[model samples]
Target: MAPVASPTLLARLLLAVAFAAAGVAAWAEHRADLARRAEGAAFAKRYSIDVRRPSFVETAKAEATGDLAYMPLVDAAVQDAMGTVALANLEPSARKAWIESAQELTAELAAARGLSLSGLAARPGWAYHAELLAFLTYTGDRRTAPVDLTAKSARWELPARMATRLSPGDDATWGFLAGAYLETWPRLPERTTAQALPILQRAFEDPDFVRRGFGAAVAYLGVEPAARLLPKTPDALRTARDIVGKRDVPAAARLHAIWETVERETREKDLARLEELAERGDVPGRRRTAEYWLVKHPPGEFDDENGRREVGRLVEAWPEGSHGPWPRDPRAQLVQHLLAGRLASVRGTALARLGNQLTGVPDSVRARLLLAAGDRYGWERILLESGGVGSFDWTRFFTELAARELAAGDAEKAEEALSRIARPARTECDVLLVRRAVAREAGKTAEEREAEAGLALAVEDRFGAERFAGGRTVSPCVDPERWADAALLVKVASPGVSLVGYGWDGGRIGTTLVSGEATLAVPLSGLSGRRSFSIATLAGPEARASEGWVTTSTGVRGDQPEAAQAAPLPPPPAP
Candidate 1:
């Protein structure tokens, strides 16, 4: 493997400074420069709607810790470009071409960010003329040019509301290439976005670009990418209030993006990672910000858990004793939770409140959520909100999947039919989808759901005590004692040797295997009898202590066995 490039020393030292100084320095320096430039009658010279130097900005682009002498030159070039495009008297054909040229430069002006695009002239493929042709080809506009250009006003002049409608800028962000890819997005997705990206995102690691692209792709998909490329959108309006209630980016925006991706794909999309960064993440700045956003947003115990726990990190993060329900909260749970009491008592509060708040949410959308909830909670008039038969399960999202399998549509799902927990149950009793859907989601077949009660009973019998350790920072596995859900515990032991159940991925963190029967009986308690022991931490290979766990020893400790004197170390047995 090629050696990974490290971030520059200057970058590491000034990162935080860059973030802070970026604000005040920009304001002060720009203002001071504006004044000095104004003294030179810069407005008259720079504002020409006709200066046409496409190569001009190339000389002005900023170099790290470099002077800004080139900024004015670039600005003048842009003014000229915009002016060239603004010519109202130009023929429709020419104007159309100019509009095409103008769009590229104008896209960033409203965001008022990023360095000049002058360097594109250096590479013919990326050259301004080449890009303009591509844009025309991409958008399929046939209009020609004699175009008069104008100021950079139209892009940013939209009402804040309309501006919000713009899909996020991928190019201007930490994920520039990703954004660039989207900037040229064909209104309809083709084999390119779908097929090309998975390969590219895996090999690319320019941090600011690749990681961001990977994240944005995941965001658009509404699912977790490798369980690391997304962030938890805090549902607590108050928790997210600082961002939504206060700042521009809602804490939930990240999570919502992930959830939406998952909901839409509803398939377990897999990726082969060519590099690992989220773990030993070398990216920072806006890239770091994007990475942080990704890290904080995956759902809880959410394996369609046993039930997905109601995530409230944002709520939890909100300082205690804060006031008001942050109404605009992006979190579904937060919005639902805050509206809890306002609902009627008859139907379960979720449906009732949701029914009352139907306008805020869509009717079809409400139906889907309510119907799914009803699958577990039973029907009610509260669920019968006005003109609809809620869509929570419409298009047969869950059952249709099962129906397809029974209908013999998808063999992979049929082959992989196994009952794992669906979603974490909030309130220890939130509606759970016991049946239906995908090779990855729950993988239940008609047979599984038909046998849901029986299979679930068996599942409950075998692994009901299987709730694993839960938390954002906790390992994917957990301790033996922590395993409580029936789906988790199993029983077996030796004369005194019986074992209970075992945890799934959620359980079994920190556990190590020691010498035991060919089919190791999960010890109901610790390994019993004078058996050999093998052990290791959750992250590595299970080790063998010279001595095994017993009355005086920790199975893991190599030191003198503690009060739990463990059995002797297991000999390296036959492979």
Candidate 2:
């Protein structure tokens, strides 16, 4: 302007100005976007619902049937929430502006549809309640709220307000309110059967309860309280009968009814209904109780003579197509097992021998049942009468025997039982483990001790922690030098570490707390077989491997010794 600048210079100057303005606008917009994201994250954390993705709006819209009333309200509410999140990082004036505008739009949209966040219970129609329910689910997590919402009252007020409107014909409301009541009841200060039972009963008595899929919610909410308040009363019994009849009622509830009826009425006429439920062969749990009851109190058909005949018939008619005790047709096997237990009560040891003679009973199954009965003599007889080991499930037989021996503190016997597994699943690992266990219990040969030194070194390579310390213990099963070195390695590597070791059946053997470098021994000697070892560090991230520090190793140990060892001697003589 001062000199009527050349055209080219003027054009260049205007271009620079335009770029500078664009840069400032872009920077401001980027910051605003970042603030919104932060607010969205905060919102989700506080409410347990996400709004940033925006796909929720479409899902809600799709769920809307006749009209899209819920969708608009949902959209408005989400936008207002987004605005609130965006304003969190802005200046005070900007934040105030956003709040006023968002609240105004959201309140207007809510009011236009006769919706009131504060008065959601009074809202008309299932759609309004559904809308409120969905919204509350998204925004009800108050713990992470940036501002205090306590003055606004609790979110639970909505469901509490809607409880009075629950009716039989209103399937949606009935289901929603009943479910809400069950969830909210326990957390309330003065929950009682007086207030909750009526609502549940109303839902339960509804003709639509079963067909409309409300039976589960109603039965679960009703049965326990009904039973507790008026147990064995005619009304309670009637309710129980109704609940048990419903195919949708939970097994626990049905069992409760069966037991309540049996305990209250001693007459076979009343107990006969339960017998019918048992014979139906549909609900195994119910059938088991019924059959046991019939056995205890011989009814018209199940008298002592009939009971014995029934047992004989079941045994004689053993399904030939069945391969194992567990057959697709459980009736034959179930009846037999039940009869075996019942007969034992009367015949004692004789019944077990008879059970062994049954055609369908597997040797392992018979042995376990006899062992459970404390009939070791009978169990041994079954073993002797059993099919050849080649045809039998050797793994199951040996494992069960080992567990029984171990439980009785007979580690030597347990090892012996474990050694009998032909063509063992884990060759080297199982043999070494058994050898170590046997050597630990009894005395080890000098050669065995030396061989263990090689094992200890290999263990350090395969199973040792990243860092450890060294120490010594007098163990005849292991060389002193090797033991000391291995102990020291563990001490150094496992400082401030916690180790959990699990046995074969996934039971925790023990937890080791390491304060310094290491301790010479971990309490995981006897519990070895298909084991798992896990390490957790109290402090420091590098303590755990990238994948995880927990490792599971499946090998035969503590029960099978290597064939290379000095000629094995009858499983080291069971203790």
Question: Which model scores highest in TM-score?
Answer: 2
Tens digit of per-residue lDDT, candidate 1, span 432-498: 1223223224454554444433323322212111221211111112122222210111111122111
Local lDDT at 514 for model 2 = 33
Residue 6 shift from truth in candidate 2, angstroms: 99
Which 10-residue span in candidate 1 carries the lowest summed lDDT?
425-434
Q: For all candidates, what are the clash counts?
A: 95, 25
Q: Give candidate 1 misplaced runs (Cα > 4 Å).
A: 1-39, 42-74, 78-208, 211-302, 311-356, 360-575
Candidate 2's C-alpha runs over 4 A off are 1-114, 117-148, 152-507, 512-520, 523-575
lDDT of each: 0.30, 0.41
* Tens-digit per-residue lDDT, 1-575, candidate 2: 37688899999999999999999998886675455334433433233233332454345335423123334444445455544465567678655655555445533333323323322332345445544553444243332341322233234334433534533355445444444455445443354434555655555444444333233444455545444433343333444435543432333334444553554354344355554554564455544444454344332122233344444333332222223233433343443444422332233333344344346666676666576557888778977877755333555546656656766878778777766666543233334445455556546566356436545643432233222211211112222232332211112233233321211121122223333333222222233333233333322111332111111121213222121122222211122
Candidate 1 colliding pairs, count: 95
What's the residue-level lDDT of 290 in candidate 1? 29
Candidate 2 has a TM-score of 0.27
